[model samples]
Each structure stands twice: as C-alpha cells, then as structure tokens.
Target: MRIKTVQAWWVQIPIEESRQHVSDFGRLRTFDAAILRIETEDGVVGWGEGKNAAGSAGQYAALVHLLNHEFGPRLIGRDASQITAIWEDLYNGSRASAAAARGHALPELARRGLTVAAISAIDIALWDIRGKALDQPVWALLGGRSAPRLPAYASGGWADSAGIGAQLQSYVEAGGFRAVKMRVGSMDDRPQVSAQRVRAARKALGPDVELMVDAHGTYTVAEAKRFAALVEDCDLAWFEEPVTADDHRGLAEFRAATMIPIATGESECSRFDFASLISHRAADILQPDPAFCGGITEAMRIAALASSFNLRLAPHLWAGAPCFFAGLHVLAAAPSGYIVEFSLGANPMIHSLSRVPVTVQDGMIAVPDAPGLGLDMDTDVIARYARQ
Candidate 1:
C-alpha cells in the first residue's frame, strides 16, 4: 500500500500546582508534549513524540508544520519498510544546516528538534509498517535476542521535603523499582544545601535502593564537585547533568573530581554531540532521547558509540505519548542493557493518545508483541485534546 498522509499533534498536558515543586533546576512546572501521527493508504498508522519541553509549544507546532508541509510530501508512496534509506535521506539532507547551527542555539534547537522529531516519527512509522508486512512484532524485526520484559526506574520530579517521602515510598511499594532518581540543585547559591538534599533523599530511599541525582545542568564545575563529594558515601548510581550539557571540558573536570559517575546528553540531538562527551571521558553514562535525536536509527548508532566506551544507556524520558515507545524500541534493541525513567507523575494524556497504554507491571515494562511499532494511536483521543 502507498503512504497517504502524515499528521503531527502538539498538546499541552496540564500539571496542577500540587504537582509542581522545586527540583533539580527550578520549580517543577507543567510540561508540554509534542506528539506525531503518520497514516498510510491502507489505514496503517504510527505515532511518535518530539523533544518538546516546558515552554516549547511554538517550536513543536513548527515541527508539525515541517512534517506536514516539507517532510511528509517527500515520503508519500515510498516503501514504508525502507526505514534505513528514509532515515539517511533526512539526516544527510540536513548536513549543511545542521553544521551551521549549534547546541541550544534557540534557532538550532528548534531546527534540530523539529527536523529530528519528524524523521523519528517517519522511522517509527516505517518500523510499524515493516512489522505489519512481516506479520511479526517490531522487536522481532529489530532483532529479538534479549528477554521480552524490560526493567524500569522510578524517576521523581517533585522537590519539596514534604512531598518527597510519600512519592519515594509509593514507587517502592507499588512499582518494585529497585533504582530511583530524584531531583537536586534547586538553589544555586548553597552548594552545601544541595548536598543536604541529596543526603536526605539517599537516607529516605535507604541504602538498598539504588539512588540517582539529576542536577538538570544547573551547577558549576566547582559546585558539582562540592555537592558530589559531600554525598560520595551515599552510593548514588550516577550524577546527571550537574553542569550544563554543552560544557564538555567542565564535564571532564567534574568527572575527574568526583567518584560519582557522570550521566548526561538528554538535551543532545545527535551522535556527533555525543562524540565530544565520549572522547573527553566526561560522562560514565549517556542518556539520549530518541525523540530529540534522529529516532531509532540514530539512537542505535548512539547506543553503539556508548557501548564502545563501555558506558550505560539509560534514556532520559519525561514527556508524553510517543516518547516512551520510541525510547522503548531502541532500549530493547540496544546491545548493552538499559533502564528507562518512569515518572510517578503519569501523564493523563498517555492512554488517550496511545492505542495501548504501556504494559507496566511491578516496575518492569513488557515489550509489545504486535506488528509495526507494536502500538497504535487512538486518534479519537487526539481529536478530543486537539489544540484549538
């Protein structure tokens, strides 16, 4: 069947004040998600999430436009199973402009985020089509060598002292999540204060639970070191984004100073960006967002790079709809074992947008057994929440 139409949706998932608290960088706030849907001639459809963040609605809308007006037109009628060829066309085609723009260069982030998200949706759609064509699950088509069930981690977003205890305990009780991540670095001035928060969180989770800290790239090299050393005995799994993502030299220095392993690259959009971190030995683990990068194809390449250096590939996921599935496929396919960040604060829109809500059981997610990307988009929910 020929490809017919590609649609992209950008939605706002409302987070109430009770949900927001000081964490990692600033006060926890409502997050907006950029989601996509691709439809083909014979009624096959696939969905994806873009790398949209707290206040990036406009950028996500622009991405929807790019996919519909520019990118979508080119892919129509092309074999949906030709995922690799389609990916190369989009990535290589953007070479000149990608080189011209750099990291978080507002213009660059927009260009890269939109372009990457669109390509990702297409890649995911292609995988879905491939599964349907082969009458097998996407995981099988992706090469199923590992066990079907995937491990997950309880990723905390709330920051206040009053809120942290209940949220941490609930995940342990219900999710059976052995590893958990918490936010730190709410105040930039008091490095010691940050350390105290880390220590407190560690104590609350207990020594048996594997704890991880996310600074959200808010600390300076010196502050990161001071904070890490204070809780060096806390047994943190890793310190994530303590310094800004772009500062490779600073990251290398921080890695040298602290015994804690450094984890980052959630903001990164390509493998080339990861090259710097790997080359500098700046981080012990790499957290790539498939929605932010070029998609499953590029994520595989990034995972391979991380594997070469013997680093862990724990994806940074805190968005809506398609983000989890896209990350799931890559993590499942990755040679090195991986764990995904599961939010205690579940997005309400998740069930509405997905054909199947993820099969999360006791903190472990089971891979989808259906063909294509294994999940379908419930467009009815999309129509209900469509931004007016």
Candidate 2:
C-alpha cells in the first residue's frame, strides 16, 4: 500500500447566508478542499479533505501541486502508512519555506490566510490516507483514547442578545448539549455593557447552561479583564480569545487577572507555536482547529501538550463539510478532552458534502466506525458547488 497519487481540488460552495461575527464577515468563503486520492497497486483508493477556512485556496493549490508533482513522485513506492516520516519530511524540509511564510502559507497572516487553510486541507488528506492504510480511525492511529462519543457545544455565530438567546434555548431543549458558547465583543468595549448582554443571555437560558463567551480576540487586556470579572458569576465554561492572537502576553495577563478560564489556540499554527503558549501558562483552555492548526497530526500533538498542563482541548470549528469529521476523529481519540464546537446556522456544505449527513444527537457527536475518517464525498454536490 503505497501512495500512488495525491490530487487536490478547490471547492466553492455558496454559503446560503453570510457568517457574520463581531469584526469579520464571511460572505463568500473561497477554500481549497484537498482530495488526496491515495491509490494502491491493488487498485484501492481512499479520499481525504484538507480544507482551510481562512480562504487559502491559492496556497493550498500551490501545496497540491507540490504534493502531486514533487512529493508524490518521491513517495509513489513508499508505504502510505509512514505518516510520521512523511509529516516530518514535509515539516523539516518545508520548514524554511514555512518560516518564510510565517504562517502566511498557514493562517497567522491576513493575506495568506488561504495558504494556511490549504496546508490544513492537505494535511487532513494525508491523515485519511494513513488511517486507511492501517484500517483504523485517524484518532486511533494518532494514539487517541477510545470513546464512542464526545460532548459538544453550540457555537452561535453573531447572534444578538435575543437571537442568540433563542438559539441557546433550542440547543438545550433538543438534548445532547451540555454547554453553549455565544459570540461576544461585537459592540463597544465597556465591560459592564458586555456583562449586561451576558446577564440577559443567562436569564433567558437559565443558570445551568454552562455559558461561554467568545470575544473573537476583539478586546484588549483591560477590556477582556473587565468583561471577565463581571461574568464570573455567570458560570462561564471558558473565555475564548479575548485578545488578539498576537497578544500572547496580553492573554497571559488577562488570564492571571481573571477568574474565568482563558481559551485560545485556533489562530495558532503548529506545535512549536503552541509550545510557547504552554510554557508561559498563557491560557487555561486550548482550542486548536484541525483546519488552521495543520491537521489531526498537529492537533493531537497540541492536545497532548495541553493534557500535560491539565488544560482543556475544545476544537474551534466554523462550518466546513469535511472539517467536522476531521475534527471529530481527533476529538474522539483525545483523552478526557472531548467537546467540539458546532455552528447554529444551517450549513448545506456540511450536510450535503458527506456520504452520510453528520447527525448530532443530544449535543454529542457519534464517532463513525467506517474507514478513513468515516466520510465519503458527494461529487455531484461538489460539481454543482465547486468554485468556478
């Protein structure tokens, strides 16, 4: 079972509705979903999706060319199961370029957000290939603790006090959900004002909701602290990305000052990037996105590092067709850290992309027992929605 060919494609599915948060608007997400078709001499082929949500179609396209033209040529006869060596080859050999890109090819830079996204897609595809070769789920291959299911949280994007409140209520009433997170930091930076909104949400959702707030890294240390202190009584699950990703020290300061746990890492790239955050004890929770943080391989490594510090691992997911399953595989194997982020809005790409529509029952996602991430793509849907 050697990798015969690695192919990548750019897919564009029109998001029926614009995804609006505090400071950003996702009207048209142009992402590159890498379909790595690893073929065996015996004629068995497996598919994988490496999708970048930061719109890295172009960068991912470049990576796809490199993989198929350069790396694929070298790996044609090599065992597809050698994922670690291949990942190391891509990492160390690609390090100079990766450093030059400075996550520009990844997602740390605004202009090259798509490039990082592309890397994410390809990386995910590689994992799928590795899993298929071993006849195991990506999580088990990655040495994740086995669990039949994992807890989840409702990630409401850009809902106001009223709109968000209703969304939370619906999730709780539906069962399967133990926690919920709301997007915050849309308005002014007054801590008290944000507190009032949280208070209102709490009143509407009641006390046991395990409320959490995401500032989208739109606040400063002072403002984050202000909001954190006020919401201490709100029974927050965690405070996510209160300050910008650049402000690791600011996050450290904010965490030190607040009683609420500080959660971040979605914006971070590789394990090296997260190592600094862990060493500094900057955040109490880690939210690594498989799409943004390389892929399952890197995410598993990040989760392990977080476990050493007794930190929580909750992946940050927006709405990508393949990313949900990709994320689920990693979370499934993860020990103790099981909650995954979910979108409240209707996303056709996620529902229609899979061979099986991903279902969430009682706020917990069931792990698919099938091979290679347990997902199959609908090419017709891809053809209809594929970016022209």
Candidate 3:
C-alpha cells in the first residue's frame, strides 16, 4: 500500500450574506481551510485537513503550499500503513533517522505552526488510507468506539444580550440541542457587558439547557475572573480560552479562581503543548482541534493525558469535513470524551464541501461506522473554491 500521489488545496468558500454573523473575528466573509487529498498506488484515496487559525477564517495558502511542495513529496513511495513512523519523520525533519533511533523527539526549530499543521494533514490522510485498506472505520482502528452516538452542543451565538437568548434558543430548537455556547470578552467592550448577555441567554433558555462562553482567548486574567464572578450563578458548563494560549499560568490562575470548567487548545498544536497545560493544571476540559493539533494521532495522545488526569475531551470541530470527521473518530475512541461541538453557523465547508450531510438528531451525533473518515468530498465544490 504505497502512496502514489499527495495533493493539497486552499479551498475558500464564501459565506452567503444572509447567513453571515460578525463577532471578534470581524465579519467572517469566507470560510477557508488547507485540504489534503492522497491516493495510494492501488487506487485507494484518502482525505485530510489542516487548520492554521481558530474559527476556520484564516489564510491557508501557505499551509496548502507546505503540504504540496514540501511534505507531500516525501510520501511518494512510502508505506501508507506506517502512519506513526511517517508522522515522526515529518515532525523531526532531516533528523528522522536519528530521532527515530533516539526514542524521543529531536525536532527542528519549525516543529510547530504550519509544519505541524502539514504533518497533521498527512497523518490524517494516512489514517484514512489505513482504514480503507482494512475496510474498517477509523474509530474501529482506534480500538472500537466508546458508544454508538455522542451528544453535541450547538456552537454559535453572536447576537446582543436581548437577541442572544433567542439566537441560542433557535440553535436548541434547530437540532434539539441541550447545550449552547456563545462568544464573550473584548467584543462586548467589558466583562460586565458579556455577563449581561449570558444572563439574558440563561433567562431565555431556562436552567435545563446548559450554557457555555468562549472569549476566543481575548481576555486578561482579571477580566476573565470578573466575568466568572458575574455569572457565577448562571451555571456555565465551561469557560473556554479565557486567556491567550500563550499564558498557561494565567489560565491556571483563572481556573483556580472559578468553579467553571476551563477548556482550551484550538490555538495550540501538538501533544507537548498539551502536556504543559496538564502540568500547570490549567484546564478541566481539553479542547484539541484534530486539524490543528497534529491530527487524530496526537489528539489521541492528548486524550490519553485527559483520561490520565481525570479531565474531559471535547474536540474543536468548527472546520472542514476531514477535520470534523477526524474529531468524531477520536471522540468515539477517547475514554474522557464528552459531547461534540456542532457549528450552528452556516459553514459551506461542512455542508457544501461534503456529499454526506452532518446531521444531528435528538441533540446527538452518531459516530460513522463507514470505512475511512466516512466522507466523500464534493469535487464540484472543491473545483469552484480551490485557490491552489
């Protein structure tokens, strides 16, 4: 099962005006991603995705170029089944042989960021190829699924305090979602204002439904603490990325100050960074994005950390088809896995880029039993949106 070809694309799909919502990211005009497609010599094809930014709104041309021009060539004749070895080789760069022999990473200076993202894409595609080769689902290859289906929390809220409640309630009604999350921090100008919005949402949705707030890592330690105090009675399921990813100590500080669960990891890339968070006791919930955090391989490693530390796993699934599917399989296999994050906003990459629909029933998402990532790309959509 040798890899014959590897290709990547920067697919940019514009969000139709009617469905657009503006927030901290400022008018997300287009949804973008670095998508990878790999084919084996025997005609087995696999797909993957890489993320460079949070919220699926960042540039991906460079990421796509890295996969196509640099990482893609190295896999031309390699065995598709040696996924871990290939990941180590890509991660350690020219020191692949020495690093492999050393029993630990001796990575290049460019170990993180786009380099890891490129590796993430390759690793995901390799897993897809392996699953197809064995005629098993990716989760099955990960040692069988934890359950048949998992619950999902609606992940979008951008309206004002008065409108926010209705907005989140609509998300609940749309798919019978029992939990919903909304944006907090800088956009509202003050922590107090963001808290007011949360209160209004709580009043509208009532207590039975769970509520969550994400600052997009846009708040200071003090500001986050204040927000937590203001909404201490509101019963937030978790407070996500209260401080920047660069400040694990501050996040740990925030976590110490509040009873609310702290979930962070979308902006992070690799198991080493997650180990640092675990060391700091910074989070109660781990939120690794399969695309950003070295794909399914490293996500499982992070999940192991979560399970080891008595934390919960909730992958950030706000990107394209491959990334989302990768998260599903990982969550299905993760011992600490919790609910899925279903994007409530209009995402063409999730809806238009894949032939199969990502449906939610009774507020839950079923883990796909189909071979590979259980997705078929809509090539027509790719052709129209691909930039490279």
Top candidate when judged by TM-score against the true structure: 3
Q: For candidate 3, what is the lDDT? A: 0.91
Which residue window of length 10 is worst by lDDT in model 3? Answer: 53-62
* lDDT of each residue in 1-388, candidate 3, tens digit only: 9999999998888888889888888888789888899999999999999988754457787888899888899899999999999999999989989998879999999999999998888888889989999999999999889898999999999899989999999999999999999999898999999999999999999999999999999999999999999999999999999999999999999999999999999888899999999999999889998888999999999999999999999999998899999999999998999989999988888888779888998899989888999888898998898885
Candidate 3 ranges beyond 4 A from true positions: none
User: 321 in model 1: Cα distance from truth in Å?
Assistant: 2.6
What's the best-to-worst order under TM-score? 3, 1, 2
What are the RMSD figures for all models against the true structure? 4.2, 4.8, 0.9
The clash count of every prediction, one per candidate, is: 2, 16, 0
Ranking by lDDT: 3, 1, 2
Q: What lDDT score goes with residue 248 in model 3? A: 95
CA lDDT scores, all candidates in order: 0.72, 0.68, 0.91
- Write candidate 1's Cα lDDT for 1-388 as tens digits: 5677777666655556775555433454445666666667887776766654532233467767777788888888877766776776676564534533542222333346667767766776677676777778766766773668888988873555555656777777777888888777745357776676667777777888888888888888988888887888989898999999879999999999888889998888778788889999898888887777777777778889988989889877665656677677778878865787777764555555677665467778877777766666777766765665
Our model 2 lands, by Cα RMSD against the true structure, at 4.8
lDDT of 3 at 313: 95
- Residue pairs in candidate 3 whose N, alpha carbon or C atoms collide under 3 angstroms: none
